[model samples]
Target chain A: MSAVTYETEALTGRDFPERAREELRDSQLRGNIRKATTTIRAKTAEVTGELPDWQDLRRAGQAIKREAMRDLARNLEALEANVSRAGGKVHWARDAAEARWIITNLAQAAGAEMVIKVKSMTTDEIGLNPALAAAGIRPIETDLADMIVQLGHDTPSHILVPAIHKNRAEIREIFMRAMGLDHLGDQPTELTAAARRYLRERFLSAEVAISGGNFGIADTGTICVLESEGNGRMCLSLPRVLITLLGIEKVLPRFEDLEVFLQLLPRASTGERMNPYTNLWTGVREGDGPQEFHLVLLDNGRSRILADPVARETLHCIRCSRCLNVCPVYERTGGHAYNSMYQGPIGAILTPQLRGFAEAGSLPYASTLCGACFEACPVRINIPQILIHLRGEVVREKQATLGGRLGAENLAMQGALAMFEYPALMGLAQRLGRVGQKAVERDGRIDWLPPGLSGWTASRDMPALPPQSFRAWWRSRRGRP
Target chain B: MSGAREAILGSVRRATERMPTGVVELPGYRRALGLDPAALLDRFAERLKDYDVTVLRVPEAQIATTASARIAERGIRTLLIPPEFPEAWRPSGPTLVPDSGQGARELNEIGGVMAGCCVGIAESGTIVLDAGPGQGRRALTLLPDYFLCVVLARQVVGLLPEAMPRLRPAIDAGRPLTFVSGPSATADIELNRVRGVHGPRTLDVILAG
Candidate 1:
């Protein structure tokens, strides 16, 4: 990779643990995340639980995604052809820089000084707004949460609700200060009205609009965007030129396949039975929305992920954020802890693979292996298993870098391995541990430890070594020699 | 750029070729939904109502009267209707504006818009609007503050699977299709839903028997 590309894409380099530690100190942030996640989680469970055939729908979703990823080349070719036949241009982006270059060039070619955007995670992943700003073009976020985030000069903290970390008061403060509105109340209706009035002018005046596709149907060359707010629809409808940045994995084989995903995404993301609006458009028409259309298929690290047998399930993610809501770790530290465009359990597994182990190696260890994410996943991605797999990769990478020299962790593992191999040593160690426990024991628990081992006891107490080893007790009960 | 496309496709092909993906059976999905025709229409109306969308169930003869009442109730002045909209269903007293490729500026000035839906799904309270005769361009339905959609009983389907095949013709013609569940809304602020964002703030559905 070019140094320029590396420098640009390495935007999120703060380690997960450090960021999480800092985030845990914020009580207000924690309460906001807790309330938002609790509400969404309950609603999600209610709606998804109502479906008697939910498991069937999940399986179908998984199967459809797998088929699409497996046969992506053919489907993409078909999509390009269909889109071209319908009067839209398709561009191929090998990486983040290329995608940004293509989109920026498109905007410049259209002579658009500014563009209005729908909430798109892919664009955020590519750092498109910064890139656009660098090219002397302004990109306005029309989604209420995204607008709040942008106005506050903050990054998005959640997939579904970008400003879930901020409450209504914080939002009102943002509007009062930044939006030139004074005496704004902290009610949701007033906040939404302020955002609506602010964004309506931009929507009407915007010459070009950029969005992310939820599903790209190769059968009809259609791009589908599902949203609760009308901002996406406005961006899709008002602008004369529409540019959609889509991850290559989003394509489906047919329009019929949306049946499964349409059922799965809304419930999993926002816990709505159905979002307010679902916009599906194929290319351009003479006098309809977006007379000029472009679709940039981005593969910023997805193909590398698709190559892995055990880890390929990451591609099946629908960006639902259910895993984020249900994740205990996410509930505590929230999205900022992960330090990537993606967050929570899915982020723990996905971010490492997308950004590579060297940059995001610590992400896989962010999870507690609670398996809540797996259950919450609409496509049933085995996130805990992937986390363990990526942890192994990180360990192996470190070992290879060290040229086989044992690190402290490896030395500790070697000691444990030796003890496991020798029964007499194991017995001796257990007996010694009981005696050693007296120094640290307090009320039958060990609360603190030395530097290297303190992380274990930091959040939880370790039970003091038993007075009698199980093997010794067994031997005494059985009257063994 | 073509080179990039070739390389990417090559990588995908090589990657997928190594893994053995098994064929999956759909497993009686349609049978599991178990929706009846009349019940489906009622379910559709009920679901849309949950989103605060007004659903007016009237006999075919009362479409004009009910539509006019809804428009009058909303106090809408200028109304935009598709050129191919049935004259019998067009409400009186409001100055009728034809949707003849009106830009966002022109459309935004109108108070309300009325269109016909291609199909309605009961399972997910959705109305699909393909840019056809009765459904003008997408801008008309979107720019106005209030929207009234006309849905026939026959257009209602039990589930999405039953609805997709019917749109095959529209899909083949590459018409821009929009599936609207309710008026524009946001749950972004504290996860509390507030209606009326950029699309029509009010959605009134007239279900013609």
Candidate 2:
């Protein structure tokens, strides 16, 4: 059997802690993220609260996704057959490398010098832009936020709003520098108009366009792409050839399921009743949309994730990104700290699993276990539970190595277990801790700690140990009575 | 490539071997807003207005006059009209260009496009275009700066679920669908929404009975 290859480009060079430490220093990024998250959170609450059956809709979505994952192989085969029957070619990719190669070859075969792109996280996961650029095909991002990120040579920091880290002023600078404008205002109207003018010509002449699937119906061979701007429509309509890169897990059993998701997604993701446009095409239409269509089914470690029963629910995400807005850690540190295209609470669990624990093991520990992400999830994914589950997997993998068995953390945990087993030993340790903490104590809190224990105190203050242990206090009180 | 397909399917089968499988029933929640037909139309118009789209309610006979007035008001001179578009609703003054697989550049040069819709959802204030008789192709309404869609009162539904059954026939016929809730918009700049981007910036909907 050939070994499975996990996604590589989505992994980060540095661990989450190190990346977070650097991100915390940028007060401007912090301010921008806080404001954006706050605005989106309010909007989502207002719109979601309007639905009397919102909870029922979420539950139905969860059940449907669970069933889809359970019968994934059969559904995928069905999807392929239906798409082919409707005149669309279906390609299967085991991993990112294969997907990229297939897409690059297709673009080359079509003699495309430039290809327009709709905003897609799947393409970013496989690192498609660099592959296309290497093949000498210019890929133009037509989404306003994606264009801002591409023009500035920056990675996306948020799922819904890729340029969430940048305010209008920064966007203005990036647009002016990239578009070669002498003067550009920072107002959103001016910036959007500039993008429309810049991308209109590209859309008119592009031969090929690429997008990520929001949902692919297995029964009818329908592919859905939902967006706020008309960029998605332009790409889906104008291009002669349309290529959609869909994860294997994005398939739904029936077309009517859109009723549940269409209601949930827009409200949860962008806090709108409905986005400006949603494009759905089955395959090649004679004179309407793309004459040639290709659907690339990408596994890229999704099957490996599905193997584990506890963590498999991660596949149920609709990319609504409400979790990112509600998460305390994501709000304070921003998405750059997560070091993956899938950021915030979802990223913490998803990246580690998709890229393997060895490459992204530190991501599971990036959260505060706040439980906000679980409540905010549209499909009812138990994210905090999955975080704990992934953390166990990370620890178990580490313990398999000799270095991990004898590591400082393992020894400390063993020693603490022994101390807790004996009351006298526990008392002695508490007294010693009280004495040791006095040196770093300030205003009844430990503001600093020695190197081994400093990780906790770096971002927070630990309350000073009480004068007497709780056990001792209870004993003394009983004696006095 | 076939080997990759087999490998992926094999792994998925192995991964899900232990998981339980059964029929997952969809919820039985109410599909409609439970409003009268008049209220549904009012709700639809209100929702569209929230997105800053201009909405006009006209009698069936006055659709042409109202649409023509809207076109002249917006100063649209040249219009792209699908051949299947109802002759009764065709405006008088503008030079109507029939859709003949026009390139994007040519479509952009035209002032606006007018079409009929398949269904309208009041809950989301959305209209679905299924390349049906009068709707023409997807690009006809997409590239132009202005779009005027005529939605008969009978076409409006109370909710998304209600609209689904109406769209199934179009799906079975292999037609492409576009759902437009409003004009093109973006909130990418610090979550401040600015309408008008790649799609038509100005949207006028004639709600006729």
Candidate 3:
């Protein structure tokens, strides 16, 4: 009944920083990014502004997800068992490769040539389209934004708003380029019309549809996909064979949990009190929706995640993308900077936890600790706390790989650790620092630093060491040891 | 409901037991919001505006005939209405399709009419649509181009959670349940708000006196 997609990523290791950096420096991208995110933020705020108890719903949302995580295994098993029992097939994947193999096999077995895909980050994470392309099955994104990204051959920049990196003008260009319109107008309505026209034929025609669930309810054995577009409907309904690739973590405990999320997600994502659409289905019906349903439950490192008790809750993310909208770094650099299927604060916390910082490379440092993501999060995930946790993992990973850190920083940390662990040694070290303070002192702070530490010192001045040891001060002030 | 659901259904049954029914009273949702009995209509009007649902406040006497004329005027056919759509409010020309069940009754074409269980959370512009007595079948609200919901002065609440207690009995009975906010829309197409995707394109609300 229970299926896992990713047991591990089997990454080539943390060695691809340079390749990712070049893609992050596009001026057109920066301008497009700023305009797109700001506008969505404003629109969501406007929509969510109409409701009260948003805060309560957010708290409720957080509680529900917490409950889901606490009982993930049971829920996932139930969901898988139910789908299987309902005459639907269930596929378990260990990672993207496994998932692609399972899906490609299914497609080939079904003799399908073209694929219509609903908006799914899991599919993107697994590189499903490219895999399908290589296998001679063309995968077309059905979600309007996803289709826009597909047509343009561009990686999605935002979580919910994938095309957020491209403005109306850029879209006009993408539309003209992809849809082959020579004189496409640069207005929102016009562009939207063109895109809608282009995709309408695909919607009514696509024989196979692939999707992701917002929540996979374990109890009723249901899959929930909350979207604003009717394209999900077409992808879901028109297709004779429907294949869904969902994360193992998307399962919830009960139907009632959906109530809390139904209220929480739209408000958090686009700031709407309630989403315009929420579709929940058990299994394939006699004459409704897709006749044949296949659910590929992906672990893709989730079991590895489950093994790590400290970071597994990162699995409970609802993909609301609310955190991204409010993220300061995500706003400036945009999604491409994070360089993963996920972006922004939730991505910062969840990605590093799922993929690990060693292979993820520098993503752990991609946060300002502003706590906006935590505040905006519907599930109330303390993103900063997780970011800090991942940073610790990153440091541990660095130390393990570097083998005792031949660098001075490791020597300092080891020396400090030894001193801190032993009180008398700590006192001597602090006293020594008090005497050494004059070397780096400038107005009670260290303004200049070395190369490795320059990134830190660029935005921060290290506070001057205490003039007198803290133990000495505490002893004097307390008149005791 | 027949196959391969033993474990999942058992788990569902177990989970429902944990939902802790009667946690809060339903009727109290209206009272807790603290509205004077007479001022209920004002609260609903405020909520209508707050939820971004357009409201057409008209006297009960003028409701059906006026509403029917409005729909006809707009040149829309295929009206999907809840089971309890008032006999007086039936419009002319449009075929009133009711309770076609899930998936079979997709709100793709035509428009719909539903009864609002309660309207609250003015800041979020949300309406709680429980497929209970008057709210009609779930499809009545979902599968339509334009949705016209009738919110009587009495059936308005400030938040969805407040309606949970009142809605539980129906849920326990395995009755249909649907919670809606704003018109059916998606912003994914180039991040532009396009109304009437799968649900109603336009949602017009009627606050009947």
Task: Compute the DockQ of candidate 2.
Answer: 0.87
TM-score between candidate 2 and the true structure: 0.95
lDDT of 2 by residue, A257-278 (tens): 8999999999999999999999
Provide per-model DockQ scores. 0.78, 0.87, 0.20
Q: TM-score of chain B only, all predictions?
A: 0.94, 0.97, 0.66
The chain A TM-scores for the candidates, taken one by one, are 0.92, 0.92, 0.87
Tens-digit lDDT string for candidate 3 (B1-209): 12223433333344333332333211111214555655655665665565456777787777777678777766777776666656877766778777555343255554556455633333234555545555654444544556777666555555445555665565444343344556766666455666655455577777777
Alpha carbon lDDT of residue B81, candidate 3? 66
Best prediction by DockQ: 2
Model 3 chain A poorest 10 in a row by lDDT = A1-10
lDDT of 1 by residue, A1-481 (tens): 0011222123565677778889999999999999999999999999999888888888889888888888888999999998998999999999999999999999998899999999898998888998988888899988888888888888778878889999888889888988887678899998888888888888999899999999999988989999878888899988889999999999999888988899899988888888888988888877778889999999999988999988999999999999999999999998887777688888888878877777788889998898999998999999999899999888887778664347778777779989999999999999898887788899889998878988789889988987888888898889555
Worst 10 residues of 1 chain A by lDDT: A1-10
- The best candidate by lDDT is 2
lDDT of 3 at A309: 49
Q: Candidate 1 vs candidate 2: which has greater DockQ?
A: 2
TM-score of each: 0.95, 0.95, 0.78
